[model samples]
Target: MIRIETPLTDETVERLRAGDRVLISGVIYTARDAAHKRMVEALQRGEPPPFDLKGQIIYYVGPTPPKPGQVIGSAGPTTAIRMDKYVEPLLKLGLKGMIGKGYRSPQVKELLVKYKAVYFAAVGGVAVLLAKAIKSSEVIAYEDLGTEAIRRLIVEDFPVIVANDIYGGDIFEEGRRRFARIDL
Candidate 1:
């Protein structure tokens, strides 16, 4: 069980190659479609974002409300394709990684290769299980957006699959074909 800490150290990112199963710990920020748009706009306007991107990993999710004594509610990965447009520029700004589910576009794939970034896939659904990993959470930006707001969450043993990696390797495609039943 590989464990990754936030502000992903080079050693950590490098260790996270394609096809690795990892349990991520430390702080991760949540930003879905709406929040991503606002973040990009803020960057375009030359305004400093509420959080730093360097060595950071953004988790794509809009989690449910937590019960008392819980750091966060059911947290899970959302589809990542929607955020493709925003990732590259963020990558250019030193964003090293992202955590979400589903496939990404060629542009995003290219950016990953160009910037030596990685895309990790958190299991879709299984929110209750996922929430168990989050130790704490706080809204850091776009509060008016409610659950879609960006939040910084500290986690422990957060499970994920490395879907895409710096070398341009993609596990989803390969895994799909490898497991698909073919009647020839």
Candidate 2:
């Protein structure tokens, strides 16, 4: 298993490949559709984003409210394709990694290669298991959006798989092809 920390550098991102199991630790941000729209709007207006984009990772999740004594709740990945429109602009701003689930659009995949970025997939329906990796959380922007609010998360040994790598490898496509040959 490969272990990676946040604020990934180009060198680190380049070293990853599709289908690699990764344990990601350190800081990542949370945002879903609403938050992403706001961010894109801010950029269109020539305003800066709520957080710096340099070498950051964004997790596409809208988690359940934490129960008492918990840092986060049910923090599973949302459909990655929903955020496809906002991805290229963020990638251009030095965003290096994303953690979510499912396939991204071909446009987004091409941008991943162009920007030397990678996309990681967290297992769906396993939010409770995933929340254990979050050490702390604080809302940093758009709190009015409730669960969709942008928050900073500090994670430790969070598990994910590289779904799309810097060189244009895509696990979803590869997995489909592999399964198609199964003679069951």
Candidate 3:
């Protein structure tokens, strides 16, 4: 398995492709629908909403409460579509990648192509397994949003699959076709 630590450089992003099995290490910021909306609004007003996203990976998630001693609670990926509205602007701002489940809208896909950004997917509903990789997590913004607040998480060998690559390859579509039973 390939390992990726963040502040994701362009060269590192170029090495990644759809279907690559990766073990991600280093820091990632978590943001979901509510936080995303706030961030987008902040961007619109030409104000910094906290956190420098350039060359960073954004994990679409809202984790549960940590079970004492744990750095974070079950932190699996959230649905990708919910964050679609925020993707393009961020992509334009040098955002290198996204980590979430399911598909993005056509416009988001278009931005992925235009900006050569990529999207990765983590296992859905597998929070326990997902949380173990998080070595640390802390709130960085949107504190009043609670769990929906933005958090910076330090991870060690977090497992993931590249769902969409910069070249427009899509694992979800390919997998569905590969596993489909066609009637003869």
lDDT of candidates 1 onward, in order: 0.88, 0.95, 0.88
> Please, what are the lDDT tens digits per residue for candidate 3 over residues 1-184?
7898888887887888889999999888999999989999999999975888888889999999898788888888899998998888788788888999997787887788788788999989898999999988999998999998999999899999988887788888888888786655
Better of 1 and 2 by lDDT: 2
Off by over 4 Å in 1: 180-184
Summarize candidate 2's per-residue lDDT along 42-105 as a digit string, tens digits.
9999999999999999999998999999998899999999999999889989999999989999
Q: What is residue 25's positional error in candidate 1, in angstroms?
A: 1.0
Instruction: Give the alpha carbon lDDT tens digit for every residue of 94-131 in model 1.
Output: 88889998999988988888887889998886989998
**Alpha-carbon RMSD to native, per candidate:** 1.5, 0.6, 1.4
Q: Which sequence of candidate numbers ranks them by lDDT, best first?
A: 2, 3, 1
Using TM-score as the measure, the top candidate is 2
Q: Which run of 10 residues does model 3 get worst, by summed lDDT?
A: 175-184
